[model samples]
Target: SFQIKINLTAPTLIFPGIEAHGPYSIVGKTDTSLIYLNNKDEKRVMYLVEIVKFCDATLEKVLNEVKLRIFQNKFWKKPPLLGELDLDIMKAYEREITKRLRHHKQIRRWESFVNGRPILPTMKHM
Candidate 1:
């Protein structure tokens, strides 16, 4: 008779130690972390998902503002086609602006997303 033994261990998850959102990037850290540049060209660390959502929300806000500005008669007397405005490039600008704004706000890596909702926290009783 032969005896056999096996060893099993879960792999360690590697975190990037930073995160980004729109032009605003946050740096702090969470259980998991990643590093990325925020809007202000500052390098920081945070939870990856936090930065992604933050940047996304910031970008949405920026785009809406840009659209409104473009509609203003001071900027454009005549309504312009989306194609004429090179929305593709404008999108890049929006992203950059969001990044910058986030940086200006001093968002560091691992910070919570805007609105401060818990990340998947279960409903709590009062």
Candidate 2:
């Protein structure tokens, strides 16, 4: 899964908030969400990752981007691995999701999203 893209971006692992590909460092934004394989019985997760610079102008924008990405399902993070990442923004995101999506409940919480799609009731009209 370390394949390089034409633009040279690393392939991202297919975790929530991530675009499907082959790039990730095997981290997490929070412990609540988890990932697993279909053939083996193990739990896993890949949190969001972002590039940061050592300047005030970019520093001010970091928090805003974190919030924006969460709302847009762009990336995630796990504690300890990258402490600089702020997860407080997840509060607003969870509230908004409960308002807009059906049967989503609380993002990933302790429950696994079985097979990604079938966990939700079959939607014949899709």
Candidate 3:
């Protein structure tokens, strides 16, 4: 069996006088058998269906929808940091989410490479 795991750790930020929060993590895992017999029951191949499914769900459904929503609203507090950065804290949150998403994409690509099956280009390219 082969196992692949990926984790994204969100940073904890501290404004000058305010307390720190988070440094939370989100993890995704894939497990697959090394060999699978085909329909004819005469051939075995490196079975990566589980890994592909995991990567698809993690990158598209979980990361893009669920995690982005959490980062945009759930984990952010606006009024507290309004005075510190001299700008809307929402902007900072947006920047942080973008950075984290980019990092996650890179990690996914690297994981795909290591597993010998690269993923197709994401929606951004199309």
lDDT value for candidate 3? 0.36
Worst lDDT window (10 residues) for model 3? Answer: 19-28
Candidates in descending lDDT order: 1, 3, 2
Candidate 1 lDDT over residue span 11-37, tens digit each: 222234322233222122333332334
Best by TM-score: 3
Model 1's TM-score against the true structure:
0.25
Among residues 3 or more apart in sequence or in different chains, the pairs in candidate 3 whose N, CA or C atoms overlap within 3 Å are none
Please give the CA lDDT of all the candidate structures: 0.42, 0.33, 0.36
Residue-by-residue lDDT tens digits, candidate 3, 1-113? 66778664432222222212212211112322222222353222222222232333332332343344445454587533223332333333334445555777888877777
lDDT value for model 1: 0.42
Please report how far candidate 2 places residue 48 from its true position, in Å: 12
What is every candidate's alpha-carbon RMSD to the true fold? 15.8, 16.8, 17.2
TM-score, each model? 0.25, 0.19, 0.31
Count of clashing residue pairs in every prediction? 33, 14, 0
* Model 1 alpha-carbon miss at residue 96, Å: 0.6
